[model samples]
Target: MNAKKGNTKLVLLTVAILVLGSVFWVYASFSLLGPKDLGVEYTHEDYVNALEKTGIQIEYEGMTGEELEEYKLNAEKKSIHDYNFEFSDYEQKQFTLTAAESTALLNEIAPGFWWFDDLQVKVLPDGTMEGSSTADIKRLKEDLYSDVADDVPLPLPDSLNIYSKGRVSVVNNQLSGDPENFYLGAVQLPDKYLEEESVNTMEDYFPRIYTVVPGLEITSLTSNSNGEFVFDGVIPQKVSVTKK
Candidate 1:
C-alpha cells in the first residue's frame, strides 16, 4: 500500500513538473519575441526600421480601413524578404521553427494584411505544408470598405475557413543563381484545393518569398515528430528577397 502511494506521488509530481515546464516554455517564447508590432501598431520603432530598410516609409497617422490594408500589402511586397526584417539566417543552414515562432515571424513580415479570425501553418513530414485560416465575413467586408451600409450588421455566415495542403521544395533560381544558391520551389500542390476565391486571393496577394545565398542547398524537406521542418542538405542562408 505504501509503495503504491509513493508511486502515485511520484506520478503526480512528474505531471506537475511537466505542466510548469509547458507554461514556462510558452511564457519564455512570447516574452523573448515580445509584441512584434504589426497592423495598427505600425508606428513602433522596429516597424519603422523595417519599413525604412525596404523603402516603405509612409505615414499612418490618419489611415484606416481599406487605405490601411493597401499600405500593409505594399509594405509586405517590399520587405517580405529583406535582410534582418524577414530572412535572418546568419548561418546559411536550414532550421525548423516552432508554430509560435513562425506565427510571430509571419505576423511581423506581413503585419495587418491578414484580418483573420483564426489561422495556422505547419510543415508536416515529406515537405507537405498544411495550412488553415478563418475570417469573419462581415468583419472582413467592413474592414475592406471605408463606409459600411446596413445599420444592423448585415446578416452573413459566421465564419469562412480556408485550407491548403501542398508539397514544397527548393530549386536554383533559373534566372539567377548557381547550384549553390537556390530559391524555394513548389514541387506540388495538394489534390484538394480550397476552391475559394478569397483563399486564392489571399495566397496571390501576399508577396512571393525566395532565397539568395551562396552555397546553400536543400535536397529534401521533412519534419520530425514535433513537426519541425528539417532540411536534408545544407540549409541555405535565409537571405530571401521579394523577387516580384
Candidate 2:
C-alpha cells in the first residue's frame, strides 16, 4: 500500500477506538440513572400511602429469606398453579404465605380500580412479591432478561435491566427474583396509553399501599419515551389476609 493510504487508515483506526471507549463509559455511567430520571424519589411516606390507598395493611409475620422457599412451594401446590421463579442474590428477604393466603393477600393488597389480567402473584416468606396482570407477561420477561441483536451499530445497554424496570405479567404466572434489590414504590403516568384513564388510576394508587408493607418497598415507576407506564420496584415480603 502507498504511504499516504497507510497514514489515512491509521488515523481512522485511532478515531474509531476513541469513539468506542467513549460510548462504553457513557453506558456504564447512566445504566443506573433511569430510576432517578423517572421521578420515583422513594420515601417513608410513599410506603405508608401505598397500603392506605389500597385499603390494606401489612401485618409482619417475621419471616426471613430462608423461610421464603417453603412459602413459595406452598403457594404453588395449594393454588394448583405451576410457576417458575428467579431472584437476585441481593434481593432475598423474609415472607410468610400459602396458596390460599397468597390469593387473599393479592386481592386485598391490590387496588380495586386496577385489574391485573394474568396475575402471577409470587409472595416470598419474607413478605416480598412480584404481582402483575396476565396482559403484561411477555414484555415483563423481555425486560427482565434483556436481548439484543448482533447487527445493531449503536450499542445500547438493555434498557429494561432489573434496575430500569420491573417485570409485569398480566397473563402468565412466572415470577423471578434474580435482581432482588430493595427500592421504594414510585408510580408515574403510563406513557403510551395515557388516553385510557384506567391506567391512570394505577399510577395514582401504587404508592399508597407501600406504607403498611414495612418489609416492602416500591423502588421506581416509569414509562417509555412513548409514554407507556412501566412499574418496577420491590417488596420486603408478602402480605396476606386470612379468613377470620
Candidate 3:
C-alpha cells in the first residue's frame, strides 16, 4: 500500500509540472507575437503625397562632414515657434489623409521615434485611432532605466507587442486625449497604469497643428470605415523648413 501511494503522488507531480510548463509557453508566445495586420500598406510615394497635401517641404540634400554638423547645430537651436506661419498670407482649407498616408507621414517625420518596428496606425470608423508596433526592448531599457544601477539585473523580455487605441482632438490649441485601451503584448494595462502625466506626455508627442500653421484649426477630425481621416482646417500656402 505504501509503494502504490508513492507512485500515484509522483504521477500527479509530473502532470502538474507539465500543465504549468504549457501555460508558460502559451503566455510567452502571445506576448512575443506582434499585433494582427491592418491590411493597409504605405510606400514612399504615399509619404511624398502626404507631405504635399500638408503643404510642408523637406529640403535636405546629401551633406557631408562639416555641412551635416552645421545643419544639425542649426536645427537644434530652432523650435516650432521659430517657423514662419504667415497666417495672413493663407486661407483656411480642408484636406483628408488616408490611413496609409498618415502612417507614411509619421514614418518619414520620425522613423524609430518611439523605438517601434513597423509601426502602423489606423483610424477607426468611430474616430478612434489605433496603433500597433513591436517595441524594441533594448532601446526602451536604455531610455527608461538610464538612472538605474547597472549592477541590478532587470528581467525583461527581448521585445514586446504594443497596441493602443485613443480619441484625439485639439483642445485649446493643444493635442488632447486619454488612451481608451493600452496593451503590452497580450496583457492589457489597467487604468491605474495610465496615469494623467503619461497621458499628457502622449498628447505632447504630436506637434500642435495650429502652431504648425497659424490660424489653422481642426474644424472636424473624423474617420470612415475605410480608415481615412478627414481634416477640415486652414492650410498655409507653403510650409518651409530652413535653418534660419
Best by TM-score: 3
Residue-wise lDDT of candidate 3 within 47-144, one digit each (tens)?
A: 77887787654333334335543554433322333333233435555677898998887655433224556678888877788888776665554544
| Candidate 1 lDDT for residue 162 | 43
Best by lDDT: 3
Candidate with the larger TM-score of 2 and 3? 3
List the candidates ranked by TM-score, beginning with the highest.
3, 1, 2
Each candidate structure's TM-score, on Cα atoms with residue i matched to residue i, is 0.31, 0.27, 0.54
Residues 177-202 of candidate 2: C-alpha lDDT, one tens digit per residue: 22233222223323443333534443
Give every collision pair in model 1: 92-237, 93-235, 94-235
lDDT-wise, the better of 1 and 2 is 1
Cand. 3 TM to true fold? 0.54
State the displacement of the C-alpha of residue 165, model 2, in Å, after optimal TM-score superposition: 14
- Superposed by TM-score, candidate 1 places the C-alpha of residue 19 at a distance from the truth, in angstroms, of 47
Ranking of all predicted structures according to lDDT, beginning with the best and ending with the worst: 3, 1, 2
Which runs in model 2 stand beyond 4 Å of their true positions?
1-10, 22-36, 59-139, 142-238, 241-244
Native-to-model Cα distance after best TM-score fit, residue 164 in candidate 3, in Å: 1.2
